[model samples]
Each structure stands twice: as C-alpha cells, then as structure tokens.
Target chain A: MASNAGVAQSRALPGPVRFITSSIGAKVVMAVSGFVLVGFVLVHMIGNLQIFLGPEAINRYGNFLQGLGELLWVFRLGLLAALIAHVASAARLVILNQSARPINYSHNDYVQVKFAARTMPISGIVVLAFIIFHLAHFTGGKVQPELFHFQDELGQHDIYAMVTLGFQNWFISGFYIVANALLALHLSHGVSSMFQTLGVTAPAWRPLTHALGPVIGTIIFIGNVGIPLACSLGLVAIPAGAM
Target chain B: MHLTLHVWRQKSANDKGRLVQYEVDNISSDMSFLEMLDVFNESLIAKGEEPVAFDHDCREGICGACSLVINGIPHGPDEGTTVCQLHMRRFKDGDTIYIEPWRAKAFPVIRDLIVDRTAFDRIQQAGGFITINTGGAPDANALPIAKTEADLAMDAAACIGCGACVAACPNASAMLFVGAKVSQFLHLPQGHPERARRVKAMVEQMDAEGFGNCTNHYECMAACPKEIDVRVIAELNLEFMKAKISGRE
Candidate 1:
C-alpha cells in the first residue's frame, strides 16, 4: 500500500508545480509579468519624452541604448519573455474562464464590473497589435525605410527624424493615439488587478490600491499621446541640423 | 398585486431547460419571494401540472439552500439579502422578473432553480476541517484567540455555502467561497496545525473542480448574500504562496 501510494504521489503534480498550474497560478504569472511590462512602459515613455529636449538629447539617448549592444539584446530578450508569459497565461485563463460557463445567462447584468475590466481582452489584443506595428515602424525600419533611415549631425541614428516623420502621417498618428487610448483602458484594470492577484490588497489600502490603475493609466496615456499629438501639430519639430 | 415571472424549468439533469412564464395574481406585498413561489406551486398542483422545482430550507435565509438569480442579480436586487428573505414589496405590480438557476459548468441545473452544489461539499471535504481529539469540549477561552482574529474568522465563517458568489461571478469562479472556507480556518488557532496542508489540499481540489479564476471584478462580493469580502481571496493566495514556498504540500 505504501509503495502504491508513493508511486501515485510521484505521478501527480507536486505542490509548487500544482500551484503554478492552477487557475490562480496563471493569474499570478499574468500579474507579475504585467508588473514588469508596466515598468518597461513607464521607463520607455520617460526615455521617449526626451524629444522635448531637442535632437541632440534624443539622439544621444538612442546612441546610449545602442551603446549597450549585446547587453541591450539581453534586456530585449527579458522584455520579450515577460510579454510572452503575460500573453500565454492570459490566453489560457481566458479559455478556462469561458469553459467554466458553458451556458450563457440571457440577461447578464454588470453591477460593479467596470468597462475597463469588461474589455481587458479586447484592449490587450489591440495593445499587442500596436506593439508589433510599433516595432516594425521604429525598431525594424521595415515599414517605411526611406523616412526611418536618417542620421543626426553627430552621426547617431536620427530617432528624432524617424519619430517626427512617422507621426506626421495622419493615419499613423491616429492609430497611435487610438492604441494608446486602449492601452490606458487596459492598464486601468490591469494595474490594480495585479496587486489583487499578488495578495497585496488590504482593507486599509483599498482606496490607494483602487486608484493605482487609473492613475498610472492616465499618466501613460497622456505621456504617450502627447508625443504623437505634438509631432502631428508641429509643436515639436526635428531640428534643422539633425535632419 | 400581479407579477409575471420567467422562471427557468428543466425536467432533470440531462434536460435542456428554458424560460417558462407564469403569472401570479393577488400576491401580497408582504409575501417573501419563496412564499410567492409556494403560491404559484399550489396553483400548479391544482391544475394537475408539475410544480416548479427549487431548493429552499430554513426559509429564513440561514440554510443557504435558496439559490435563485432574479433579474440578473443573485438573490434579487437588494444587497446582502438572500432570496428567501426577499419580499415581493421590493417589486412593483405588473413587473416582469427574469429568474434563472445558478449557472456554472460545475453546478449543473437539477431542476428549475435548483443546482447541484455538491461540488462545494467536495471542495469542503478536501480540507475544510481540523483534526480534533475525541473528548469533552475544551473551554472557549483556552485557545486564546485575539478578538480581531476571532471577528475576522466569524466574518468568513458567515459563508453559508449557497454558491451565490459563484453565481454572481462573470467567470463562474468559486474563489470567494473557497477563500471564505480557508480564511475561516486560517484565523483560528485550531487551524494552525494543518494550515499549509489545508490550503494546498483545498486549492488543488478547487482547481480540479474546473471553476474559473478570479479577475477581481468584485461582482461576487456585490452579489454575495453573506457579503463575504473579496479580500479573502487575497488571503487564500497568500496562504497558497506561503505553503508552496515552505515546501509543505
């Protein structure tokens, strides 16, 4: 009996493994990866905001990142891993959640469910598509190489020219604006939800916890959208020397 | 008062149910929701038709047997009140109420508003207990539990296993129910010995039962008859993390 029990135990998932495999486990993975991605977005926005400081500052920033070289690739790989984990876990969770309720309630109502929470998957997909387009436009230089390929006066990759040229196009600027709006919605739900999933929510901190999502989401939205808006409106122009 | 109710009706577990409309006339405003159902059932019996089946015991709302989703809100529009305690006065005359069973893949419809909530019992059986010595009752003060902890335990203990939290959840998650059971024990000294093991066993059982995960929508808390806090879910997650980290399955 003892041997049989031991064999069965070995066949079954161990405690930690089982914990990560469960629904809550998937949620925890999404939450943690979301935190990493949120941090990246904030830093990326701060870096991009250097456009206000003129061509040299922005080009210097780009050069600094390029200077990291192989280490930069390592950072890129880490961000990629976080994105993949977040997406995969969320996809699995969505499937499991849909399967849990085979029948639909004809008159389902939303009492406390927010618009942001209801549209998380939709916003997440939009943000994902935007991320791919963004990479193609800037990182890969494959979208419009003619405009994307330029060098600043200091012989650095002309990020300022690329950003201005890209956003000056009405369609591209509009897409960026819309995508950032959706990202705001996604973050509004996702930020506070991460705290809840990680078990950091306490009754004493309810107000602060609830406000975290919307606050961060608004800041990101304003910061990101401000760039494209300023670019299209000619408020921030590519410096003459840099072009 | 006259009211129209679109109550869900199914003959058995395998039967595909649909909404069957019934009209109840001359219902007093003071009549409880279940009492109104009793009147309708009487009329059905007189007409030689099958009475609508539903679960209800201790009609005072403590039994947790009453499970009904009225107009998309579990237990009716009022917060913190069970279906058994809901009165007809809350609705206007000539109102049409949409009534349905607690819809979940795990909790199948047995008949009309009755769902097989035995899944909850199975989850409870997995770990919702403490090993006790078979002897005379110990003194209440012997455990030396802090008043705050005792209060929190009682708050969680108020869960009646009615499955309202699951019904109210968009994902059909039983997290609140499982969290309540785990929290109730976690706060008490008697639950210390089996703390890690209990959380692991119960969480494993919950996953095996195929309930959806919580996404912090807070609908379950709003729809809960006992008003169980969603924070308990955080507690459950914390306990599960500690158990896994401690390597104590």
Candidate 2:
C-alpha cells in the first residue's frame, strides 16, 4: 500500500494554468479588474466633486495631479491594464455564455434575476464606450480643443473653465448624465456580484454587499451628475470674465 | 378547467422546433401536471397524431427524471416542486401554458419537449464518487459525523440533478449542480482522499460540456427543485482555488 504513497498524480485534473482559462478563472479576472475599475470610478467622482468648492479647489487639485508627472502616467497605465483585463475577460465569458444556449426559449420568464443583472453586458459596453469619449473630450481635449485653451486669473491652466464651458452645452451635459447613469447601473450590479464571483461573500454577508452596491452606485451618480447639472444651470462656471 | 397549451414540437434533433398550440378541456385541478399531459397525449394518439414526448419517472419528485419548463419557469411555478409533483390546480381556467424542453448547447433536443441530458451523466462520471473496497458492507456509524456537517452534506446531497438550475440561469450555467455534487462529498471524510482530483476533474468536464459561466443571478437557487443553495457554488469555487494553490496535496 505504501508503494505508491505519493505517486498519484494531478495529471488527470486541470492544472493552475488551465484553471485560469476556465469559466471561473475568467470570472476571477473580471472580478479583480472590475474591483480596480470600481475603485477608480469612486475616487474619480469624489475628486471631481471638488468643483463644488469652486475653481480654486478643483483647479488646484487638477494642477496637483498634473504635477505628479510620471507618477500620473503610471496610474493611468495601471488603469489601462485593468480596463483591458476586465474587457477581455468579459469578451471571453460573453462568447461562452452565448454559445451555451444554442437554442432560445420562447418565454424566458425569470424568477429572481433583476434588471441590472440582465443588462450587465449592455450597460458595461455602453459604459466602456462612454469612458473613451470622456477621456477624449476632457483629457485629450480633441473633441473640444477650444475648451483646453482657458486659464484662471492666476494664469494657471483653467480646468474649471474647460469643464464648466463644456458642460454648458446641453448635449455635453446630457451625455454625461446619461452615461454616468449607465455607469451607475453597471456598478450597482457589478459591485456586489463581484464578491460572489470572488467567493468572498459568505451567505450572511450577501445582503450587506448587495445593499452596498446600489448605495455606492447612487452616490457616484449623484456626485458626478451634480457638477454637470450645476454647470448646465449656470450655478458653477468661470463667470463673465474670470479668465 | 379548460386550458390552451403551447408546446415546442420538434420531430428530431435536426428539426427546427416551433410552438404548436392545442386546446385541453376538462382538466381536473387535482390531477398532477404529468397526468394532465398524459391525458392530452392520449387524446392526440386517438386522433392518430404523434403525442408529445416528455420525460418522467416515479411521478414522485425523487428520481429527477421529470424535466420541463412550464410557463417559462422550470418545474412550473411552485417553489421547491418538480413538474411531476406540480398539481394542475396551480393554473386558472382558460389559462395558456407554454411547455418546452431544457435548453442548452450541451442538452440538444431529441424530440417534442425531450432533450438529451446525458451531459449531466457524463459530468457525474468524471469524479462524482469515491472508491470503495469490495466484498462486505462497512459497520454502521463507524465514522463519527457531526450534526452540522451532516446537515450541510445532506442539504447538498438533496440535489436530484434535475437540470432546472441551468434552465433558470441567465447564462444557463451548471455551477449549482456541480457545486451540489462537489459539496456533498466535500463535507464528508470519505471524500477527502480524492478531493483535489474530484474538484478539478468535474469542473474541467463541466467546462468541456460547454455550460455557461456563473454571473451570480442566483436564479439557479430559485428554480432548484431541491432548493440547493448557491453556497455550494461558493464552496466549489473555494475548493478550486485551494486546489490550484496547493495541488497534489
């Protein structure tokens, strides 16, 4: 009996490398990266909320971020990496999810699945597209190069002017509101469900985590949309001749 | 009560199915759902038409042989009830019911309302058991089992492998079934010897069978006839993660 004491092999089983490529593995990737992105969005919204403190606070915050130089690029690259991982894992899972049901049910009456859960892929896709547009419009200044040229009375780069002016346009403000709403919808489901995927949510912890998602989602939505809504309403702006 | 039935009718696996409607009258509320179907099938046979082919066995909820998605919910609308145990009384008069086979790429339709579920059997065969010595039965109560552990094990063991979880899942994932099977053994000492291999093998087999990924909708728990908790799925994930880190242990 001792002849083969340590000889039985895991050769019959999937190895670590293979497990990472499995459905559950792809889920793990998505959850981890989704978490990174979730943290990014929350922090981004909170930082931008400083616009309520008026031009001095938000612009100084922007200047402080810009002064980080290479550190800023590092953070951006890290976010980019997380974005790729999240999207790639999603693409892999979507294909498998689609192919799993070759046939369609005539009546797919779900008992417990909610709207946010059902619309995950679509909401996620829209949010991704919105992220690209947001970066181009705000950071690259390509969409509105005109908004990039303003400076405060102190002659510092006037992010306050750019954002307020950009948001003054109903189209720009409306898009931000709509896109952030979708982002909130995506997070409302993703934030809690990611715990389940990571196997970190105990049965007792489920209710808390599930409730936490929507609350955080609502906060993010309100924080982000509050600025644009204020800007479009002329409550927060660069004034008649502040520049 | 009179009812209208819309059933998916497929001549063969290669045939493209369609919802074919029929009228059923005088269905007794006391009759079980399968009995209602049998009555309809009998009438169809009398008309020289091929009766609908569905799966059922024991007519009691234990065997897990009965499979159906009635009115879009697997095993009908009753919670923790199988189709065979679902009494026709649950429906109202003049109501329209839609019946369809279990839908999945792995579970192909064979005929009217019957799909091949051998995919499940294959998954079970992968590593759903422990090796036992032959010749004589072991002494009863030889191994001391704690109440909590036994309760947990039995809870998972309640799964009858009905595939309703797959029907209810938005992704059509089979994690609940695989979770129940893996957890049933995991809570017992006899299951320890092959723990690593069993988890990995079964999961690999499940993936190869082309089931979808679990996105945590938990509809599987609701549709489950046995009321198997998705906590088993969490255990399955925990075990897989552990196995990955400390393989060959």
Q: Tell me the tens digit of each residue's lDDT in model 2 across B1-249.
A: 999999999999999989999999879999999999999999999999999999999998999988899988999999999999999989999999999999988788899988888878878888999988887888878999899889889999999998999988878899999999999999999999998888877887788777899998999999999999988987888787777778754
Best by lDDT: 1
RMSD of 1: 2.8
Q: How far in Å is the alpha carbon of A132 misplaced in model 1?
A: 0.8
Q: Model 2: how many Å of interface RMSD?
A: 7.3
Runs in model 2 lying further than 4 Å from the true structure: A1-17, A239-241, B135-142
RMSD in Å for all candidates? 2.8, 4.3
**A1-243 in candidate 2: lDDT tens per residue?**
111221122234456547667767777888889999999998998899999898999889998999999999999999999999899888888888999998888888899998998888898898888899999998999989998978877777898889988998999899889988988888898898777777762678878888978988899899988999999999997767655
TM-score of the candidate numbered 1? 0.96
